[model samples]
Target: MEFEVQVRGRTARRWIMFGMIALGAMFLAIGLVLTGVTASFLSDAKRARGSVVALEWRDDDHGASGKTLEHDTPVAYPVVEFTSADGMPRKFRSSAGSNPPSYQKGDLVEVLYRADSPEDAQVNGFASLWLLPLIFGGVGLGLSGAGTAVAMVRRWRS
Candidate 1:
């Protein structure tokens, strides 16, 4: 004989608990990856002075031409030029992305790069270097703690 089971509040809460655990796990994994990348960058980077050559902008409006200029949400990318230790002039785009343009053309900025290859250079700032890991790790820790607490509470209730 086929059996029909009635869903209870506890069963629904258990499903919710599982969902929270999954979300928390996903964030934790991303946070760990970002932390590792940040660690690698900090280990062997040399500081150099670079100048912003120009601002590159990309419209966020998904190729919607003929739209009003107000709809153009352009993000600014700073193109930096620096001379490596080998006396070769190298130009690279900063990895930092922002709206309203944090830098201007001809602005001098500090850049950090590996000595052997200057192409993988990044702007020398907390926002450029550690912001991603800090944000991901903070959110991951909070969500994971909340999920663990919820699982414990559900277990106690059962």
Candidate 2:
């Protein structure tokens, strides 16, 4: 009975280790794919100077009870207006936002857009282009390293 219990415990540990490694690999793959996509976009994108025309507000609460708090503030995403390569005016809201607001109305910022789809412009900044990939990749490396360390320790103990 004791031997059976020990075997079961080992099996569970193995499964846990495997799960961590698998999840880490998945995150790493997603990060790599996102990095590639960002690189591709940057390669063919056109740069333009845009002005922050307005701020679009979004609720920060993730579907919690609709109680309003004085300290709670809505995230403000900047809406930028710029002219495309062909001299046509275009507007797009940035994907990233902050609590206190990152940009004010009339603030000029760099914009990147594809000539074919000028309306699908994005703010040209590190946060807009590489933040997600870096986060995912870092998490992936941490998790994977932890799992590998666990496996090594288990083997050393045996």
Candidate 3:
């Protein structure tokens, strides 16, 4: 009976350790992806004058009836049109959106893009360019740190 209890305890410890490692890996992966994306965006980034073609809304629907629907602050992605360094006309939808709609049709804005692939672009601004990577990287670092702390504590205790 005592031996069985000991085996069970060991199994539980292994499972817990595995869980911590898996969680840490997941966070690290997220951090790496965000860092890579940010790096890619910054590489060969070119700026151009563009105009917002329209404010598009992504709507969210609420509970059971579906008749009672709620809109998620009416955020809109700016559809920007610009000419690339190679003089190719390109239009892209900025991934960044905001509540109360940040832009309107025909609004002039700065656009940042890669010369090689102008279709891959973003509206030139701090939020559009940097917010996601910063937030994701910060959270990932926090989670990874916590996981490492847990592992170290376990090793010390053992």
Candidate 4:
């Protein structure tokens, strides 16, 4: 009471898929390690009334200002400079971002630090988001390996 699949086409394709799986897994592992290192070294350093040293850009003023949440308008966000709990000066910013920060210059903001290393930190609260990509990469790697292994075994028996 079992269903047997009769694979067709090129048998060599199985080995190719197996190779791809191994390669994907390798990339996945590397990505995981990188994200882990980053998460370990630095995190969202939540600071109390953390002072904003500068504003890099202005998102959306809508011609409205004064304690109002930033809107769709384009503004400048200043690069905020602050001292870590360890008394080390740090520059907080959005990654790969050319635009400005949403907050105003000299604005106080919150921060957080990596679980392993508090010296390094990020301005955004979602620093832990780094794990998402890492997790996805790991899954992709594992799936690829599994697929390859299954195919190889099937081909071997065939």
Best by lDDT: 2
Off by over 4 Å in 3: 1-10, 60-74, 104-106
Model 2 residue 5 lDDT score: 100
Model 1 over residues 1-158: C-alpha lDDT tens digits? 12323356657777777777777778878888998987787788877889999999876455446564766687888999998777888899877767989899999998888897788999887778888877777777777788889988867987
Q: Which ten residues in a row have the lowest lDDT in candidate 3?
A: 66-75
lDDT of 4 by residue, 126-156 (tens): 4234655666687777768777777778779
TM-score result, candidate 1: 0.79
41-112: candidate 3 lDDT, tens digit per residue: 777699899999877776543557655455435567778889989988888888888776688889999988
- Rate residue 13 of model 1 by lDDT: 70
The digit string of per-residue lDDT tens for model 2 on 35-131 reads 9999999999999999999999987655366776667779999999999999999999998888788899999999999999998889998888999
- Ranked by lDDT from best down, the candidates are 2, 1, 3, 4
Candidate 4 stretches greater than 4 Å from native: 1-12, 42-78, 86-89, 96-108, 113-120, 127-139, 142-146, 149-158
What value does the lDDT take at residue 138 in candidate 4?
72
Error of 4 at 73 (Å): 15
Q: Cα RMSD (Å) between model 1 and the true structure?
A: 4.1
* lDDT (0 to 1) per candidate: 0.81, 0.90, 0.78, 0.58
Q: Where does candidate 2 stray beyond 4 Å?
A: 61-72
Give the clashing pairs for model 2. Answer: none
